[model samples]
Target: MPNCNAHDPYTQVASISIADYDYPLPESRIAQAPCAPRDAAKLLVDGPSRPIDAHFSHLNDYLPPASPLVVNDSKVIHARLAMQRSSGGRFELFLLEPIEPASYEAMFAARGPVRWHCLMGRAQRWRDDTALTLGSHPDETLRARRIPPHTGGEGIVELSWATGETFAELLDRLGQIPIPPYLGRCATADDNQWYQTVYARHEGSVAAPTAGLHLTAPLLRTLEDAGHPILHTTLHVGAGTFLPVKGDSIGAHPMHSERTVITRRLLQGLLAASAPVVAVGTTSMRTLESLYWLGAQLIDSQGPAALHLPQWTPYQTDRTPPTAESLQALLKRMDTLRVDTLEASTSLIIAPGYTFHVANALITNFHQPRSTLLLLVAALIGARWRALYDHALRGDYRFLSYGDGMILFNRNCKKA
Candidate 1:
């Protein structure tokens, strides 16, 4: 692709080779289960001069005083369902997003039949017209059929069930929590609670925002006591978070869009913040950074009704506005429209060359090699991310979801 703004960081970072992000992750380091007390997990504080090792319970000690923490409270739905063909062959349907009604809230409230974009486990054997049934429950019957693919070539499945209950209820009774596949095991009894964050509220995500999994109720209280403002926004994590960078360069990889909902209160907090805005997870970081660009679009008079962010929007322009100015513009628009919440989808990719506008620090877990999550870390700390990873590996810290976490500050930020 051609560089529209030669001096911009996005232009430099967008063309970076994915191979540069690769690192050796031993299968032994992948944590399959979480520690007993979530706060007992280890924390690697990526300090200014060197990385400091500490327990997660001591996270407050590492944070800059009075920092506002933004967390993703999008809950993980039981999106994985097991079904059987009449011949007794079994298959699974992994729900991605609502299809028919095109809204998560509307789809969950819907009764009887609902359509969704899904990935079939035994897709080859599932004929177009054939139907599959959930385990024989006499009172509540559930059935599924393969529908035509979406315009993007993703498979769509139609699910029909009747129990005088909402689709959400049916899922709670029959579906399993879709844990990360790297766990190399089926979703067990513990995952229903273990994989979810204590702060999780809205039901939509297929996967857990793992970094939030390390926070316990007491830890949250301690932070509040220390005068750190704890707030939340929602970003329903998608299955695409697990997808690897397919090509050599990031420019060739397609980014997935996730839905976000930010409240007027959160916007006000951000505008009034006198300290660094700390994002509790990659999802939250993405949401905060995307808000800046969304606000920029609003300043440009982009239609508020249609507010989907494209992947390359940041790179397309060199117009860097003051963060507060952009945020105030959004607040002005919200006031004129008389809305308390702003809902939009973002496909923003935070790579090495990306400039930080909102979040000044990030708290997150170790990510997979060559993954977009790792790239986001690189964007904050630059190549020192490699050194931090090396230190974590050498120090015997566990990796991935259900493992340890770290607190990283952006190099450009004053707190660092």
Candidate 2:
């Protein structure tokens, strides 16, 4: 692939290998169930300044009191489907992302026509050219026909549903929320709601924005009443969220592209707000950083509808120079056009040596070891991630999506 001048700075940064981000997480620490009344969960506040243990309910105390809190409102759908082969052998089908309309023989795995792969279960048993039918007919019908194969042992599965009935409607009836295998249980009635965040609105993601799951309606109301600005962006979480980096060097790892959207109004709000920007989850953080690097200005509304930022692409632009004001202006113009949102694909992976263009603080949950989430946490706080993980291990912070939360304030921003 040819390199773009816009990505030069990113290319110059020293890449951190996947091994540096690995940590020791006990199997017992992974939470199988959510804390009753989500906000009641624990929170571990760690930084170079000080490390403190607290409950998620006290999240406001760590904030600046009036800073803008940006969150990803992308909702998780029941993307997991159970299908039987011709021999009556059951296999699992997890929807990664939407490639085409639910009714028009849509594509899966990654969007676009060229790469339409999806992760399939029982790979050893299922042949390369297997087909699985989903849903009952008369009202609506859906089927998944396997196409060619791809790396990581996944293959393309073309989906088709009945006409007049939208894909969303078909999924509502035939699909199950594609929870991580680490959850160690079958989907239940509670999963339909517990797996999703209270603020979830956009319906495109296959995985839940776990960090946002800790927030409750009361907590949001409190933040709003306290004069803190809140804005939302959407990034449809894909199967890539769970793919582990296999290569020793970050460069060798294949970055998966996921769809993201940032509205002009949300951008304007971030620029105009007197307080610093705090991201609610990693998805929101990625969207803000990607947009900020794209020379997105309130004035660039008419130029393009969506922006694509691949992981290997540099996050800075010479014309833009990566500034908060410029990003805010870009978002403001989007808002003015009532283009509150812009959709694009991102393969950008945040790690150490990468400079953050947006978000001063983050509210996230602890992630699994050897996962991209762990690498992101390490990048946010430098080497302190190791020490923090050690602290959590000793202090009993539940690990993974349903576990405890953390409020990470970037030390680099403080020094700057």
Candidate 3:
């Protein structure tokens, strides 16, 4: 009794709901701590042909000999803060995103316009709105003012600083890095380094690009020495990545939008390179695929009569078929003029029906059940995800960010 249109198989699989993606994970398997030396973790290479088990230190062996590896260079910021109220009440603040410099608000369950909102904590005694003071520094003093709430259960707070310095500086002086809740541990001194990727460049993401966390400078040098190229893209990992799909069907769940930037030079390299393009993490894969779709749209519009003559009338068209190179040049020119370079917010949920325009192979960490990450994995390898997960679980391969990784090659890859 399911609708089975030839064009849409998703609607036909009634029993294959979001719940089907759920698997029983033991509490003990959760990696509360990361492996030392970062690259000392495990790696499980699962492909359509065979499964290879190895340590993370031997990662370079699995990559395509000389293929370029695209990496997400977004750096995690210290966003969590602690406050104490005059009433002797303590509240924990987990900074989601920046709204202002020194004085910004966060998600809290309290009603008032006062100087503080109480966050839920141990015992029922701490759940009351009380005057609180933040910052241990002598020059820093934060007074929180309650504001209107927003969607997704987030509440606003107005912050007033005692000093004239920008809010960012105050945060850097006081806030702690917000680690994942599952870690069940406070952000210690070691997290400042271990939680970050060796190639992290852009500084805005709240969460570390877990897949990139496996890459070290030595591995990168080895890749470069082997004639493989490495490109960097930015995708600020948002707190929403930790949220699970609560809907019955994966299609019914709404995906969160994340800001991403893919440079024109990187796009051109991907299009021109004869070597395969391997995405370092799912975040990088999303950025590449999103940009490729945008580029493809431009390519489709550059036909004989479809060209926007005003933008490219100065250039001559050769007899040779038009290529992505020319389009990339035009995009660069636009960028120099302060125009957007294929920039846009993407909520591109890569479920089964989505077609991949970029990325040949993916190096990623094992993901949680009923998560969007798993859907992406399923989309990449068809039914191989189940087998891969089962194999990893049985073989003692770690799971989740800070856990083991798998290098997956798309069987449906065009070149394959």
Error of 3 at 268 (Å): 2.5
Q: State the local distance difference test value for candidate 2.
A: 0.73
lDDT per prediction? 0.89, 0.73, 0.67
* Per-residue alpha-carbon lDDT of candidate 1 for residues 57-163, written as tens digits (9 for 90 to 100): 99999999999999999999999989898899999889998888788888888887899998888688888778999957756778998887534335888889868
Off by over 4 Å in 3: 1-16, 100-132, 149-152, 162-166, 296-343
Worst 10 residues of 2 by lDDT: 107-116
After superposition, the stretches of candidate 2 with alpha carbons farther than 4 Å from their true spots are 1-15, 102-117, 122-131, 135-141, 147-155, 296-306, 315-322, 328-340, 414-416
lDDT of 3 by residue, 291-343 (tens): 64444445545433222222111111112223354446447545655654434
**Model 1, C-alpha of 84: deviation from truth (Å):** 1.6
When 1 and 2 are scored with lDDT, the better candidate is 1
User: Where is model 1 more than 4 Å wrong at Cα?
Assistant: 1-11, 149-153, 414-416
Clashing pairs in 3: 85-132, 101-167, 102-167
Residue 379's lDDT in candidate 1:
89
Q: Estimate each model's TM-score.
A: 0.96, 0.85, 0.80
